[model samples]
Target: MIQSTTPGKMDRLAAFIEVFKLRIAVVSTPHASSPGSPALLLAGSEDEGNARVVFRLHGFSEVPDDVRVVAEVNFDNEANPLMSALPDEISVPLGGSVALQATAMAFLSEAAEGRCGRSAALNRLAEVLMLMVLRSAIDSGAQQPGLLAGLAHASLHRALVSIHEMPAHPWTVDDLAASAAMSRSAFMSSFRTTVGMTPMAYLGAWRLTLARRHLKAGEAVKLTARRAGFGSAAAFSRAFSRAYGHAPADLKRAGASAL
Candidate 1:
């Protein structure tokens, strides 16, 4: 039986939690793009040949397509490949945007979880999958690192790993610099050259991201705030609102009822 705090409200919360958790499970699981967990690629005849589906966690879009997307869930930005480069077929012949939901996550679950240590394994696997996508995209000439070409450098990889491993470690420039085994000045310089943000900013973004996921999973706000390293629920709310454009309460309400 499901747990509940308020009659109708509990049902709504559970539904919201299930939807987001399922999405996370699919994305984080191995074999997310396999036959069993296929991604929905919406593109035109022209796009069919050129389009590729790239899934990256935290720093990248959930489903990065070079076409417009129509789906129930999303994690994209203005820089999203789909928003920027969707093929003409989507507008001309496909009749509308493409929708790919649930199927891909299904396959990912089968391959990633191995039917044991599911969510925990996926937590580690998400980074591996992201790196694979990044390497492939760069090799295939689909993504350009621009002046940030150093982003593909080894230091960037190290920094990413450090952030992922100690997301709640109250990281600072000094801490991250120590992790990267470089002086504060050098680490900051190299990090900016490749990753495009100052160390502190990146840390904040990473923390906010984890907080958002916990929120989606129906974790209590105060708990989520503390785990994400915020000092209090109010602080977490202010930061979350600033980063995501919505208060934690508003987001919880939307996730529960408006999803």
Candidate 2:
């Protein structure tokens, strides 16, 4: 369930926490990274040598696409400490945390048993482990201009929550500034500095992202347009094409083809 602390009202840290939903995929040696996915690496000593686990996070699916963009902008085909750019082959030391060790063992046990009732329990463990990784990254002061930077800034967090919570709302720079309790000029500069995009630009990207999801879910174009805050189907189509390099109908067809 998406947290319901009322978007613009939550404290910065709480707001940040609400934006993640744990998604996990475990692989043995030689893990492959999924594009646009953030992950946590867990590694520890094994009987023979060492063991590793990859917890692939689809958490960004819960965040606005614009926010994801901020977190991912620096990502490239190179090694980086930032989670989004984390190398596929890196083995993160499972820092001697007993609680984490217990949780990891439990997850492995559940996976081996393949019990239906244990899925939720495993998911909760994955969420906890992911948080542990994120906390370590933040505590280490891994400076990457994205979600971490936005979360660190009180004002930017407020604006980000508003955007995430109400992508359908007709948000303007002035309104977002009011939400952040800052002057228009300060809000613009600070948002760009921390989030790497102007408020309106972020909103536009976010809305289009929502529209894409809706379309993929088989929502009609006109309804998707309205729900995504577009003035009309044509406008939404133009913007969607600009953002994603394809028309909504094309995406719908592609989704159908996949099935």
Candidate 3:
């Protein structure tokens, strides 16, 4: 019998952004080489400095603690993948063609302007920059294990897609291995090596991530637990608390307080 590959709705990289709620804040600085050239910089500050452009991933939150900063990069003459090449706070140079730089500069300029309806335009431009950075990172070849490494590996990418497509599925090592067309042992080893976590560990984290969103949206604990593939609300609460450093109830209360 011929086996079918599992269907994936979103690209793994895009799914990563969704799961983590990543956002981009761009600040334009004076170009070092050319005084008049506007150098677009990705910043961590929530405040848009001097009318900077901010682009948020899907389901962005204004709360700083709620946002997870996966990695930070400093663009240089050479473009490289940020996640795998550096530790938590390392800066990597972003290298791209002249055309790419020109396009980015144009977008930054438009984003920085005070035109009406510019927020929407800035958002679109920020999305473009995110893709550009990803492309440059892939081209540079990531040497470390991370989302970048997983994307670069065929088997790992397939596994990642399956996980993201069906987060509620009760997945197992064997099942994921089958999806990736690899033996269970090989799959387990390769996944940990590339993604920097065991398959089940990653799945648990993914589930809790989804659960947080549901809870924030005011879903009942039982419903959120079920949707996140936990056996019971109690179990889900424990896992959620462990991962987020707070009980689900606390988060729910905080969410309510915000309103």
Please give the CA lDDT of all the candidate structures. Answer: 0.48, 0.58, 0.57
What TM-score would each prediction reach against the true structure?
Answer: 0.49, 0.63, 0.63
RMSD of each: 14.4, 9.0, 10.4
| lDDT at 48, model 2 | 32
Window of ten residues with lowest summed lDDT in model 2: 66-75
Candidate 1 residue lDDT tens string, 1-259: 2424743211212222232232222343222333322133322233354433343222222434443322222323222322122221121222221322222243345453478766555433433333233333332322333212332354454455556545667777887777567788998887776656677777787678677767766778998899888878998899999987888876665563433
- Name model 1 segments beyond 4 Å from true: 1-135, 138-151, 256-259
The pairs that clash in candidate 2 are none
Span of 10 residues, lowest total lDDT, candidate 3: 68-77
Off by over 4 Å in 3: 1-10, 17-102, 105-119, 138-141, 256-259
Indicate the residue-level lDDT of 208 in model 3: 80
**1 against 2, candidate with superior TM-score:** 2
Residue 253, model 3: lDDT of 65
Model 2 C-alpha lDDT per residue in residues 85-182, reported as the tens digit of each score: 22222223443466666766776677568788776665566666665655544433325556557655656767766776677788888999988899
TM-score of 2: 0.63
Off by over 4 Å in 2: 1-22, 27-40, 45-124, 131-144
